[model samples]
Target: MPRIVLHDYFRSSASYRVRIALNLKGLAYDQHPVSLVAGEQQSPEYKALNPQGFVPMVEIDGERVTQSLAIFDRLDALVEEPPFVPSDPPGRAHVLALALTVACDIHPLNNLRVLRYLKTELGQPQEAVDAWYRHWVVEGLAALEALAAPQAGTFLYGDQLSMADICLVPQLYNGRRFDVPMDAYPTLLRAEAATLALAPVEAAHPDRQETAQ
Candidate 1:
């Protein structure tokens, strides 16, 4: 297999999700950090690699994969041992539904580009922008908490950590970043705590600092 190279930013929740997936699968990859805050994602060189100019682009065996969900599916197909999606039909559908609840229904509105546009173009005040962020998070999380019942085991669906857990950890991380109160979702809090206890997941945490050069 050709070396897997991931173009990502440490702070991006999308990139963070992919990183967690890679770590969970025990796949080794090279990291090429793209600083979204510094406008590096919009440069001609990076744009040529990804016209969308988004973080979390993955190059695997010379095939470039864009979109976090697509990249995750590819990784899941490549390594079948630790399955990310459930095998049973109904369970699989439920897991995918929960993952999409976060990836599609919630994440886009809170993306960095959208926030930047809100501040610069719409001239939305910081308080309003933050309110928007919290609103989506709280609404989405309420639905997700309902989906992740106490009947479910340590992880989201059951004892095993599936894609839903992978998606939830980063979104919860972002929610705390934005000061969205999490006390309402005790099940989600427990699931996140259990998922993070795993060695691979803990190693992949975004805040883990790199050594000085």
Candidate 2:
């Protein structure tokens, strides 16, 4: 098999999602840290590799792919067993809906770039920026809690760990970072606890992947 390489920032939720997918697929890969705080992602050489200068850029099968959701899908396709995504159309729809609630709706607003813009360009204080992060997190997770509360089992969609759980664990990590109150989403917390118990999911945690200074 060709070597799999991942370019990611330790704190990026987008990068974190790809890490979970790779672990679930049981693939061994090299991770190259890109320090978003130090602006490593904006370096010309890195931008040449990923025009968008995004973290979680992955090289698989000699092809470079960007976007965590796209990488998540590719990994599911590459490995059949221990699938991160569902096969049935209805199952896929439900899982993607939950995943997108985090990946698309929640993540972008609180992304590093957006937060930087809020603090630097928009001239918001750290307290205000942190409040911004918490507000959106609470809003999105509240809706997600309602959606998953009805059908969630050990994982978001059922007993099987699907893409929904993969997307969720990292976002929950972020929620904790900004001190977002989590008790409002008990179902999400339950799924997160179960997902984190999995050896693969544990391996993917950002704390485990941090680059030594």
TM-score, each model? 0.95, 0.96
Q: Which lDDT tens digits does candidate 2 get at residues 19-52? A: 8888888888999899998999999999989999
For model 2, the superposed segments whose C-alpha errors exceed 4 Å read none
The lDDT per prediction is 0.88, 0.89
In candidate 2, residue 211 scores what lDDT?
A: 77
lDDT of 2 at 146: 92
- Assess the local accuracy of residue 112 in candidate 2 as a C-alpha lDDT between 0 and 100: 86
Q: Candidate 2 — what's its lDDT?
A: 0.89
Worst 10 residues of 2 by lDDT: 204-213
Give the Å shift of residue 65 in candidate 1: 0.7
Per-prediction count of colliding residue pairs?
0, 0
